[model samples]
Target: MDMSTEDDEDEIESAEEEKEEEKESVEAESEVIDETIILADYMRRFETRRMQELAAKKEKAEEKKKQLRYLIGVEEKRKRDVSVETIITPEDELTVSDRVSTESLVHPCLREIDISESQLKILNPYTVYRVPDDPGLSPAFWLLRERPPIYGTDGVQKFYDMVKRAGIRSIASLKDLLITDQIDLRYYGLESQVMRAICEALMDNTYVRKVDLKDNKLSADACKHLNNLLLRNSMIINLSLSGCQIGASGAEKLYNAISTNATLKTLDLSNCNIGNEGFEYIASALSNNQGLESIDLSNNNLDESCAENLRNLLSYNETLTHLNLFWNSLYSAKTWKTLIKGFEKNETLRSLNLSWNGLGVECLPYLSQLLSRSRSIDKLDLSCNRFTEKDAIRIAKALSTNNTLQELYLGNNPVKAEGALALVHAITPHVSPDNVLHLLDLENVWANKDILHELEAIKMLKPEVKVKLRGILSNYQLVGPDIKKILLKRANYEAMAPKIKRRKRNFGHFVMSLSDKMISQEKFMALIKKFKLKLSKSLINEIMLAFEGPRGTVDQGQLKSFYVKEFSEATVN
Candidate 1:
């Protein structure tokens, strides 16, 4: 082959190797099991580890940049010192060295406070303090907290009047308000002319980007001020009005403001209790709004009607990418299935979270089927749902044809061994270099060792797909759907009482320790006596006949499950 073709082959191999390395890294680090745990909890661990690693990486990069800057500063200082030696006296050289100290270059943002004792006690020289104790204050709308004295919500009218009344620092201190990154005033419940006052703050100040008024119970009263803030200020992009209890009217006003403001990117109104009408208003606003990218509308008591409004919003909104509708029961059998068409049509949406919705096995086909057809979505989380073996089959079928999906999180689902086997069989044909599923997070789905073995055996088909399987309570067992029907046969034995099956039952623990396979006649008696277990030859034969896989070894999960069934609650003396 030509050099170009050889180079392309090398790149492909390198990419595959990197994918394998990541899978190995995840497998080595993650010990997620215990099938009963929530997917959110499991994912939190994953996210936490990832965040820590990212933070460390970022800190290292920053440190390196700082060192580079320090070195450059030293080199420049040395050059200046050499020039001073040639031109000035020893006293002038000392002055130059003292003036050009490296600390000055270490941080450019740090400034000194040269104000008189009359100035308020701010956190640092860089921070602006809006102290409520000013003598000339006319019913000031700020409550001072100790230690740097940051202002919380007091009232919008007072703020507006404070700005209107001239000689309040002559609007000189307002310059500091422009560049502040965080303006947090949670639970002040300030009303009346707040938006106009904030607009005044935003007129010249360009840096106060985050304004948090959480738990302030902000309503329609404050939305006018919020509307003005949006209309006037383009710098405020991230706004959190969570726990404000902003009702439908306030939401409508906020929606109107959002439609006018193009700078807002991440809007969080979570737990606002905004109902269907409020959602309708927001939907209308989002349909026209272009700059807003992420929205958190969780815990809004939203239902089918609200979901439909969101469906409409997702259909047209191109700039809005991440939509979080967690903890909302926006799905009935028909309602959710209908929404699948909307999900398929929307191409701009990247992350869709329908978690904790009780979308059962039947509902999964609609989503998986949508995945097969849609081209936009890359991350799909169907965790904390009741997934049956049929659900696994449906998802596997979708993965076989779908190409855009990169991450699939199906944790906390009851896709036991049988479902896992069927999923493995379906995914094997599609496990390839170009497979849509790069991260198959099946953590805590009750996959046993045999199920893991079956999946690992199929690595020759595609090693790029990383399957995370294990339960915290499985004692390192492979947890998966018993697709091979090896572990489920003893399920029928539960009808037989423990007393009836006591003598007839196979010694599961004994058989486990003796070669980890179907017990041979040679070691049966010795193994049984050594483990002090009661096991008859007929019982062993019966178990092998019932639950043995192709390799003549019963699945460990099956054996353990059978023992549980045969002796439902019986404990050894």
Candidate 2:
């Protein structure tokens, strides 16, 4: 019984082990299925990630294509805009007219007309068109007759038909009316008629900014009509009465008009015989007038007193920027001094033209002082003056101190070698590598070889400074190069020679030697020839012989006789 019980326990143990083994086998199978499911899930995730990446790439490519199209569209638009603004031919310019044709009507959406292809040549865009003889007749018919088609009358007819088909009624469109010199009597000789027409045009509100009555025979009555128009007209900006016979009284009336008119900016009274009285009238207007910016009183009979009045006006007026006082005889140094004194206090005076005036050497010192003090005077014209070397030197010194003065005119001033040298020395202190004197008119200054050398030195020192030496004594016969060299060397020697040497024993002997070695007749003649003098041979020989004696042995009688004889001969000549 004990053996059978032990056998049963062993059998029970074996059955329990088999049951545990089956349970482990079932768990392993479950683990394998779980591993397969995990593998499938990983594969599906990878495929989904790849698909997302492909979709992102396609979207990016599409975006790039869209951007490229946008860029191309922008480029095309820029090209079209550029073509619209660019003027291709003479006829592509803007005209003062409004005429429509069939082609323009076809493109009804286009707001702007392209009349660039049309050929209607007209001079003077400010000219007023005369009213037609018959207002009933269409302006287009006259335009067609005046400007015929080069191809044929049939082409003109076709053009007319095109306009008619476009339903363009009353071709007298203000847009098609161009102000040409031929149509406007104002540009020609009909002064009174032009004045009347201009008045009518002003009444009709035709935009006329400028009225050029230049070189016209407009009398006081005509000017009165124009002045009345100017006083009432709001659009006119420039009134040119150049070369007219507007006397002092007329100028006074014009000045009154300018004072009252708010839109007049440029008033040209050039060559109008407006005397000091007329200038005084203008000066009175200049006190309270804020609209007048430019007044050209050139070629008038304005003297020193007139300029004084003008200067006074400038001192008070701030709006007058450009005052052209050219070709007037207000060039006395005292007068300029007074003007510059006033200018120093006035901050608005910019340009003063004193060209062709006789500002002599005596005037330079005071003028230089005045210029140095005046900070507002920027452009000063002292051209065509009788200024000497000393005068130029003083002026240059003043320029060095006057920082506001930019343009200086010294043309035709007879600035020779000495003057140029002085100017070079004076400007050396103020000039720099960057800031330099811009415009220097040294034309016809009678520059010699020495002056040229100084100019070259100035250029080397201040390479940035533009030095203009146009026509610098090109016609005058300068000293020959070799002769100039000798003369310069002699001058240097003379300068370096001892004025008072140390007193040595036998100084008297040295003086005697110098007297013996004094220049001879032959040497003096050679010097005269070297200087290129045109003295007669006989006169030269005589002068040489008379002055040839040794310093101590000079014959005063012979020298006096020769001088008297030469003087008599010169007087006769």
Candidate 3:
């Protein structure tokens, strides 16, 4: 009994010892796992810290680069509080207060001149609102919800039609259709039929500001329907019936609708095959017109008689700043002369685009006279005018005297160096560091090396003059790099031009000196080696006979006779 009891107790003791060993093993393994986790966390922290340090180092390097660029006078992209043109004018210079003022130029106290949108730049004034395709994710979630887009509905016409069909007549739906670039009802139905419906519906609209019916090609009779629409829609700002086959009678009806209407701002009656009668009607409308700012009468079959009528309209009438009479040249001297007189008297007009006009050099004096007057033309486009060098010179002389003119385009003309040099020499003195002519386009004009040099000299004198000297010209030659360079420094203009001539004149003088001192072979070979001169045996004999002129070989006349063919433009072919 004792032996059995001892055996059982030993077995129990052994089991307890095994359990203690297993517990120790588990505790040791737990310690190892904990150590591993702690080491992994430390490694992750070290990697994160290293990456952050590298990022900080890169940022500091970029900052240093910017500082270096600033020190080196390199232009860097940075936010400027004010425009570059606005500078600190001296206290004595200003007749007004020295302190910075918050007065806006476009305030109510100023006289409201009807400036066109092209001349008047709205810089950074427009906003872009992005509407998401998914209506639920849109910024204006409550205001807009996705519905099946209807077949042919502008905000005004189709929305009203749809709402009426749904048996819901709401006056508030028209307010959302206020601002739109175009109510495109083109190609859905015939323009005559569609415009009848649209114009009738527009009568009920409170403020349908602008309507575009471009390329509609509706008959002249359809314009009568718009008369009621124009009379009732007093809030209409712009009306376009471009490419609609509206004749004189239709134009007369259209003009009669908005003749007294003060709210109309722009009228576009372009490409309608409007003849001389239609032009007269439109001009008559402008005579009584008060609020029209811009009008397009392009591609009309109006001749110089129409221009005379236009001059009469411009003479008596006011409140027009933009008039596009494109695709028509002044056919007569009488017409352009009248137009020039009108331009002289007119003060409100700013931009005039007389493209494709054959206003020849004969018209330049009239244009010069117009520029000499108190005309405020900021943009004048005289492209395709075939302006000659004399015409360009006249224009340049006029441009120098004129202060209000900024952008002048004399492209596609045969204006050579004489004209270009005259323009540059005249306009350079006027262009200061502060006030400048915005642009002068001489593209496709006959600009040779002399013209280019004159322009470059002008740019060096006044960096603000943006002269466009591009386009491949006809039979124009460039001055070689070895030839006499341009006179850039006007401060030393008198001192330097003579110096360059003297330097070139020395080439002939040096050859004469060599000829005097040495034999013919040694002198010829030495001259040949130095100037890389190629003289024929016959040319040498000719030079021998011509060398001993009255003034010597270096003399301007004698130099061309002896060695060098030219020292000036007079000597060269």
Candidate 4:
């Protein structure tokens, strides 16, 4: 039994040992299963994280591509917005040192002005002055506070940016005036504040020499500010205030400023309605001021009352070269006589524009005498006057003696072919150095083919003189259609020369009996009545004009042709 008990205990212990090992193995298997589940979960999480990283990288690449496209589009847009207008002269293309070193005929005053970049920049109307809150600022700022803004206008917000680029730009140059970098503000609708701002900006500018502010209708205050600019600035050579509404008060201010200023060369106050007193003030200032070279007082309501002031100005102002008295009312002989006396005393006047002044035949003799005596006067504009053929003849006689008159403008006058012929003869059949009449403007003058032919012959002879007949109406074309039909009617005369011989010799005698080569219009009319020709007064006048000669006479050859055709047609019928 003891042996059996011990064996049972040993079996039990062995069994217990085997049970403990199985339990331990089961726990180890459970731990392995848990660790495998955790490893699978971690592998799945790692795969998901790799996918998320790839997605993020693709998104980042797309954003970078979109940003690059946006940048390229912005670069293309900038290239289209900036376009510049460039006006380059030969002188402007040269370097400043090269320009200054040349021996050209540039004036000393013009040489003092600065050279530009040789381009025409558009005037920006939006870049306006800022109305500062402080009242103690400059006058330009003070004026801006009182003035109205360019309100309700589009693109007002872009002005500040444009103001930054407004500096260091260029403008067009006046080639004839030898003026470069012109700041043209004509019809810009600039108000007082705007004018003050522009003036302030231009005050320190040394590049611009011409400031054309025509037709702005600026007030007297604006003119005062401009006068202030003139007072301080000396680089400006030409100041055109034409068509401005500045009245007598404004004129007085400018005249007072001009009296003190000496650097300004050309002052244009035309169409300003400067009254008699205003005229006297400016004329008095110009009489003493020596720097002003040209003044245009056209359409200024100047009448006979201002003639004395003009006389004094012409007499005393020695530096004044060009005086434009166009479209005024200095019509009477007395007013012109005073002006003629002034011309007689003045020796410095080079150009005189008296167009549209209603100067009649009475003024022609005095003008003729002035042309005969004045050695300094080279250009004389007498267009739109009452100068007839007789007045033209008298002027032609004076022109033969005058050697200094280079340009004679007799446009819009009634100077006919006879007068034109007389003027051409006064010049010469050939080019002569003594007769320096280079330009003879006879626009709107009616001339027949004979006169045109003679003038062409003279042109071939005297090539130096340019006889301007632009817009010259043909005298033959001026006849009515009915008169043209009557004159152009073809008689059925088959045997032309033989029929004239059979009819005589009587037509030849009649043509000779009237006159040798030409007959007067009255004599032609008398002959038409004597021949019992059925003709109207209009026809008679047209016939005379069509067959007129250089001496205001009808051609006898045309008369003989007409009578022979008439008589031959009568016999044939």
Q: Which ten residues in a row have the lowest lDDT in candidate 2?
A: 503-512
Per-model TM against the reference: 0.50, 0.48, 0.51, 0.51
Best by lDDT: 4
Q: On residues 1-573, what C-alpha lDDT tens digit does candidate 3 reach at each position?
A: 999999999999999999999999999999999999999999999999999999999999778756644443344544436778877567633533322222224332211222222333333322221343674555566357676544332346554564566555444523454445445443332345445556656665654678777877766657877876777777678888787768787888777775777778888888888888887877887888888888888777767778777886777667888877777757467777778767766778787777776778667778778766745778888877778888888887778777777888887878776676676666775443233466888776555555555566666777777887654346456766521222111112322234345423333333434433324443444664475333345444444443433323312233333334333332231
What is candidate 1's lDDT per residue for 134-228, written digit by digit as tens? 68553443344333333333223334455666423233333444457777767766554544565555544556778887887875867867876
Q: What would the TM-score be for candidate 2 when compared with the true structure? A: 0.48
Question: Of models 1 and 4, which has the larger TM-score?
Answer: 4
Candidate 4's residue-wise lDDT over 1-573, tens digit each?
999999999999999999999999999999999999999999999999999999999999767645533432322112223337755567864654355512123323223323322321214312322444866666768575665344211222223323345542222222222224577778866676655655655555566688898999988789887888788777888999899868888887777668877888999989988878789888988998889899999998888899899999998987889999999888788888899889988888899999998988867767888988989989999999988888888988898888899999998999887787777767775523478888988898765555665567667767777887644444444445544234534211211334345432233334335644777888888886685444457756876787677689988776656655555554333
Q: Would you list the C-alpha lDDT of every candidate in the order shown? A: 0.65, 0.61, 0.64, 0.72
Model 2 pairs in collision: 97-175, 97-176, 98-175, 98-176
Let me know the TM-score candidate 4 reaches against the reference structure: 0.51
lDDT (Cα, 0-100) at 481 in candidate 2: 57
Q: After superposition, how far is residue 206 of candidate 1 from its true place, in Å?
A: 0.6
Error of 4 at 300 (Å): 0.8
RMSD of 4: 25.2
Error of 2 at 238 (Å): 2.5
